[model samples]
Target: MTDPTYEFSRAITRRPAASITDGLRAEDIGTPDLGRMLASHAHYVETLKKTGAEVIELAPLESYPDAVFVEDTTLCLPQGAVMMRPGAPSRMGEVAEMEPTIRGVYDEVRQIAGPGHIEGGDILVTGREILVGRSDRTDAAGVTELTEIVSDWGHTVREVFTPPGVLHFKTDCSLLDGETILSTKRLDASGCFEGYRVLHVAEGEEAAANSIRFNQFVLAPAGFPRTTEMLRQNGYDVVEIDNVECAKLDGGMSCLSLRF
Candidate 1:
C-alpha cells in the first residue's frame, strides 16, 4: 500500500518576490536573477510532470517572500491533513492562508496549533516510521504533538536532534526509498537512528542530500552532481532545480513547495 502520508498527484508553492533577503539592494536581487529563479522553478514544474505529478501553482499573496510553505508542514495521514504551526513568526500567516486550498485538496484537514511548532522541512518518512527533527523551528512540544497525532494512524514517530548549526532536519537527511536513506555525520546518526540503515554523504553533499520525495518527484537543489548520480544509480531518476533566490535565505525544492 502507498503510505497514506505520501501522495503525488498535485503540489503547491508560493510565488517568490524580486528579493528574498532583507536589506539587500534591488541590484542584488536584480531582474535577471529573478528571471533565472522563475525559469528554474518552471523547470521544476516540468520535472514533477515527468514523475506524473501535477502542479498547483498559487499566485503570490501580497508577495510575502519569507513564508516557508506550511503546505509541506501539513502532512496527509490517512485520517487528514495536519496543519503544522510554523516556528517562524513571520511564517505563521502562511498556514492560515494555505488551509482553504488544502481543504479543497483533502476532505479532512487538522491543525498543529501554536506553542508547538513543526516545519515540514524537518520531517522524513520511511516505510515504517516518521522521523521528526526537534530543532529551533520544530521544538520539543511540536514533536510530542506530532507523535500523538500520527500514532492514531498506526505510524510510529521518532525524533532526531538537529545539530545546533543546522536549521532543519532535512538539511541533513533524506530518504532514497523505503529502506535506504541518505544522511550526514552532522546528524549524529548512532545517537538518533540506532538500528536503521543509513548512508552518510561526504561533507560536500550535506545540504544537497536533503531532497523531498513526491511520488517520483525527487526535489533537490541545482548542485549535488555526485549525490544526484548516486540517486540515479539507485534506480531513482532525479530532478535538479535552481533555488538560488530561495537558497539565499535557506529555501529549496521542499521549502518552496508542498506536494500531495
Candidate 2:
C-alpha cells in the first residue's frame, strides 16, 4: 500500500539561479556557487526521477533569489494544494509564481489569503495528523487559518513549536514514515513528537534531520556521515547529495522540492 504521507508520484523543483548568491540567509556564510548548486541539484532531480516519479523541473527565476526553495511556496496535500503566505516580505512573491504550477497539478487549489503567514517548511503530514510548527515563518494566525482550511477535508492540524533559532519546523525534524519521525535531539526534548516513534540524528549532525523520505529512499545532505549510517542501519535506502552550496543559504534536502 502507498503511504500518502511519504509516497509520491510526482515532485516539483526549480533550478538555482545565478542570483542565488543574493539569497536570504540568517548569516552570511559565503556566497553560493551557482555552478556547484546546479550540479548538486541535477543529482537531486535525477535521484527523484530514478524512483519512477515525474519530476517537474521549473526554470530559474532570476528575479527571485530564493525561488529555488520551492517547498516554501505551497503545501501539497492529498486533498489539494494550499499556497502559503510567507512571513518574510522578500519571499511573498514566490507563492504567486508557484500558484499556476500548483493549479495545473491539483484540481482543487486553495490560498491562505491572509494577514497571517505560513510556509510549507513549517509543516509535516503524518498518517494521523498534520503537525504545523509555530516559527518566525509561521504564526498562530497562520496555523489557525490552516486548521480551518484543512478541517473541511477531514484533516486535523496540530499546532506545535519550532525550536528556537531554527529557520523552519522541518529544519529540525522530518517524517520518516507513517508513525516515525527523524528529529534533532534538541527539538525532541520539547516532547512535540510524543506518541510517535522518534529517531534522533547523531549529535552535531542535526542538519540531517531535514532529510526527506521520498518514495523508497531517504534523500539527505551529504556531509552527515553518522546520520547517514544510522538511517542505513534502520533499513532506509539513503542517497546523499552535495549540500554545501545550498547550506550557505540555510537550505536543505526538504527545501529543494515539493513532492506529492
Candidate 3:
C-alpha cells in the first residue's frame, strides 16, 4: 500500500481546565461537565498513542478557558511548526504556552508575529498546497504571513473564505487524505476546495466534518451514525468516541490534538 500523505509520529494535547465549562462557544449551549470532558480528553490522548504517536499531554491552564483546544495555538508541519497569534484576545496566551513544546520537537520553528492573527484550525496542510481559511480567528494579514513562512518549505499557500457561521475553517471541513476532504455541504458549496474531491457530511451531521485521519484509522466523534457510515462505506477504519462534552464547548476530535 502507498504511504499516506499526512501520517504523524508525534502529537501534543492539553488537559481540559476546570474552567473548561467557560470556554467560548458560538451558541448558548449549556456548560459541559468538566469530569466528562476530562475523561473524553484522556481517551483522545490514548487514541493518539494508539496511532504510534508520542503524545505529549500538557497541563491545563485554568486561566485560559479555551486552552484545551490546543490545535488553535500552532500548526505543526514536517518542515517545522508555526506559533500562531489567535485573533481572539483571550486565546493569545496559548501561543506562548505552546512555543516551548513545539520548539522541543522542531529544529526550526516560526511565529506569526502580532498585527497578524492566525489559528491552526484555519490552516490545513495537504500535499504541496497549504489551504488557509480567512475566518474571524484568521485574517488576510495572517494568511499572508503564513504563506511567506511556509513558502520557504516549498508549499503553495491558498486562502479560502470560511463561511459566516463557522467558528473556524476546520470546524466545517478537514483533510481526510492527500486528495480527499471531509466537509459539510455548506463549506463544499463555498468553492474553496475546487480541485479536491469532497465527501460531504451526512445531512444534520455537520459536526462530523471536523474529524481527523490519524496514522491508520479515522478518529470520529460518536453519535453521528450517518456520517460514520459514510466513512465506513469509503473504506476507512473508523474509531468512534463520545465527544458530547467537548462538543458543548465547540470542540471536536481534530481540535484536541496537534499532530506532526
Candidate 4:
C-alpha cells in the first residue's frame, strides 16, 4: 500500500546552467542569476537527499536554457516512465537528453510519439488516477496517446483543464498525500479536486501551490509565509527554499526535479 505519489526512493535534478538567463518565461521579470540559482538548486537537492532518496544530479546543458526543469521531460510512475513531447519547440530536445537517465532507472520506458504535444508539467499522478490537463503544451491528441499507453499498465488518465494564463496544471496545485491536495483557491473553485481533501494556499500566495510532498517533507518555495504556516499547522513538515531565481524563469519546487 505504499504511495508512489509522495513516497519516492529516488529523484533526478539538473544543475542550472549559465544560460538560464535565457530560459523561457511568460514575461521578462528579470534574468535568473546563475550563482543564486545554483545555491538554491543545491539546497533543493540536499533537501531531497535528506529524505533518504538518491538524488541524481545531471550536468547542465548550456544549449538548452530550460534544461534545469527536468520534470517537464518525463513522468515517472511506479509502473514505468513516460517521455513527454514538449510543445515548446526549444524544450523538445530535453526529452532525448533525459531518455538515457530514465532508461537507466526504469526497465519499462514509454514515450509519447506524437504529432501532438504534451509536457510532463501538465500531468499529475494521484492515488486514484492520472489527471492530464489540456494546456497549451498538452492537447487532446497527446492526452489520448498517454491514455492508451498507461491504460495498458493499469492506470487511468483523466483529462482536465488548466486555468487561462497558467503555465502548467501543477502551477496551481500539488498533491500533499494519498488523498489530500494543496491547491490555490482559483483552481479549487473549478472542482478539479472534488473527491480529495483540499487545502488552499492563503489568498494572494498562489505560487505556494506548486510545492511538492516528498517522503517526509514538503519542499516549498520561500516568501509565502501564510501558505507555509498553513501547511505546517496542517501537520506537514515544510522546507522553504529560496525560489526567487527559479521563479524568474517560471520554475518551482516541483518543476526542478522528477521523483520516483
Candidate 5:
C-alpha cells in the first residue's frame, strides 16, 4: 500500500502559473466573470497536476471576448489532439486558437471540418474506445470522421446520443479509471457504451457527477456533500475544493483543463 501522506496538505501549488491563450474571450461572462472563472481555473489547474499528468495552459483570446473558452475542449485527446467544431457558434474560433497550442503539447493534431459539428464535451475515453455523443454539437458525420481518425491512431470510437434533458454526455458522464464510470443516471444509451459496466449518479446531482477524471484522480466541488459521500462510498478518494465562483458561470471542475 502507498503512504497516505497526511491525506492532502497544500504542499503543491493548486493555482496555475500559466495563463490561457489571448484568443480566448470570456466577455459574455464579463470582467467580474473573468475573476470568478480564473479563481476556479486556478483550483482546477492544481487538481490536474495531482493526477500525475502534465498540463499545458492555453491563453485566452483577447479578440473573441465571449468564448466561454477553456483549453480542454479545444485540446481533444488520447494520441493526436483534434480541435472541435464547437456546437455553440460563438465558440467556433476556439478551434483555431486551440489547434496550435495543442500541437505544441503533442506532436500530431487534427481538425474536424464542418458539414459536421462536434463539441469537446462529447468525448469520453473508456480504455481504448472513445465514445462521442451525437448531439447538436456533434453529428453522425462528425462521429464518422472522428471514428476514422481515432481508428487510424489504433483506438476505437463509439457513438452515443445525448438525451433531451442532459446538455452533453460529458456533462452527465465520465470514465473513472479503466473500469468504474460516473454517469448521470439517464442518457438513453443502451448498447452504445460497450466492453465495461457502468455506474450511474442521479440527475439531481448532475453538476457534481460531471467531473473529469484527471490521470486517475477525481475532483469535486464543496457544496455537494451527498455526491461527495457517494463517490467515497464507491472507493474513490475525491478531492473537494471551492469553486463557487466558476460554478455560477456554469464552470465545473471538468471545464478547467485537458489531461493527456
Candidate 6:
C-alpha cells in the first residue's frame, strides 16, 4: 500500500533569519554559526529538489528569529493547508506571515483559532490516521480543534501524550511508511505505536528519530552513522545531510520543510 505520509510532491521552506541566535531554544546549546547554517540550509533545499520535490523557498523574516522552523507554522494536507497557532507566543506571528504563500498554493486554507495552540511538529499523519501529541506545545484544546477540522476529511485523530523532555512528538518519532515507524526507544516504550513496526533509532543517536521519509528517499540528519546504516539496511534510499546548526535551535530534517 502507498504511504500517505510520504506522498508529497511539493514542499515549502523559509530561509533562516540572520537573528537566529535570538530564536527560542529549550536549552542554551551555544549559538549557531550563521555562515554554516546558510550553507547547510542551501544543501537541504538541493536535497529536496533532488528527491523530485518542487521546493518553494521563502525569504528570511528577520523579525521572527525562529522563522526557519517553518514546519511549525502550518500543516499541508492533501485536503488543504491549515494555518497553525504556534504554542510559543513569539512564534505565533510567523503563521500570519506564511498565510499568503500557503493560500497561493492551496485553495482550501484553514486556520486554528486561539484558546488552542497547534504546531505542526506535534502532528504526524499516517495513511490511516493522524496522531496529535498532547505536549506542552500542543494541548487538549488544540487537538480537539484539530480533530473537528480533519475528521470531516475522513481521518481519525489519535491523541498521544508526549513524554517529558521531548520538544514535540516528532522529536521522538517519524513515520517511515504506512505500517512502519522510526522512533526513539523512549517513545516506543510509551506504546503509542504498538501496532506498527517500530525501528528504533540507534543508541546515543536519539536525534535521528526526527527524519523525513519523502517520496522514495529518507532525508536523514547527517552525523548519525549508526542510524543512517540502520535505515539503509531496512531498504530505504537514504540521503543524509548536515543539520547541526538547525539542530541547535531544536530543529531537524523534518522541521525545515512543510511538505504535501
TM per candidate comes to 0.86, 0.99, 0.97, 0.99, 0.78, 0.98
After TM-score superposition, what is the CA distance of residue 48 in candidate 2 from its true location, in Å? 0.4
> What C-alpha lDDT do the candidate models reach, one value each?
0.70, 0.94, 0.88, 0.93, 0.60, 0.90
Report the poorest 10 consecutive residues by lDDT, candidate 2: 24-33
* TM-score between candidate 1 and the true structure: 0.86
Per-residue CA lDDT of candidate 3, range 1-260, in tens?
53335588888899998998789988977889999888888888888898778989899999999999999999887778889999989999999998998888889999998688999888877865888999989999999999889899878899998899788898898888888899998998978888898999999999998899888888999999999999999998888888999888778988898888
lDDT of candidate 5 at residue 184, scale 0 to 100: 62
Query: Which residue pairs come into collision in candidate 4?
Result: none
Task: Return the TM-score for candidate 5, rounded to 2 decimals.
Answer: 0.78
- Give the runs in model 5 whose Cα sits over 4 Å from its true position: 1-32, 65-75, 188-195
* Greater-TM-score candidate between 2 and 6: 2
Candidate 3 similarity to native, TM-score: 0.97
Candidate ordering by lDDT (highest first): 2, 4, 6, 3, 1, 5
**Error in Å for residue 195 of model 2:** 1.0
For residues 1-260, what per-residue lDDT tens digits would candidate 4 score against the true structure? 67889999999999988989899999898988999999999999999999999999999999999999999999999989999999999999999999999999999999999988999888888989999889888999999999999999999999999999999999999989989989989888988898999999999999999999999999999999999999999999999999999888778999999999
lDDT of 5: 0.60
Clashes, model 6: 0
RMSD of each: 3.4, 0.6, 1.4, 0.7, 6.0, 1.1
Best by lDDT: 2
lDDT of each residue in 159-248, candidate 6, tens digit only:
998889889999999988878999999999989997889999999999999999888889898999999999999999898888888888
For residues 155-257, write the lDDT of model 2, one tens digit per residue. 9999999988999999999988999999999999999899999999999999889999999999999999999999999999999999999998889999999
Q: Poorest 10 consecutive residues of model 6 by lDDT? A: 1-10
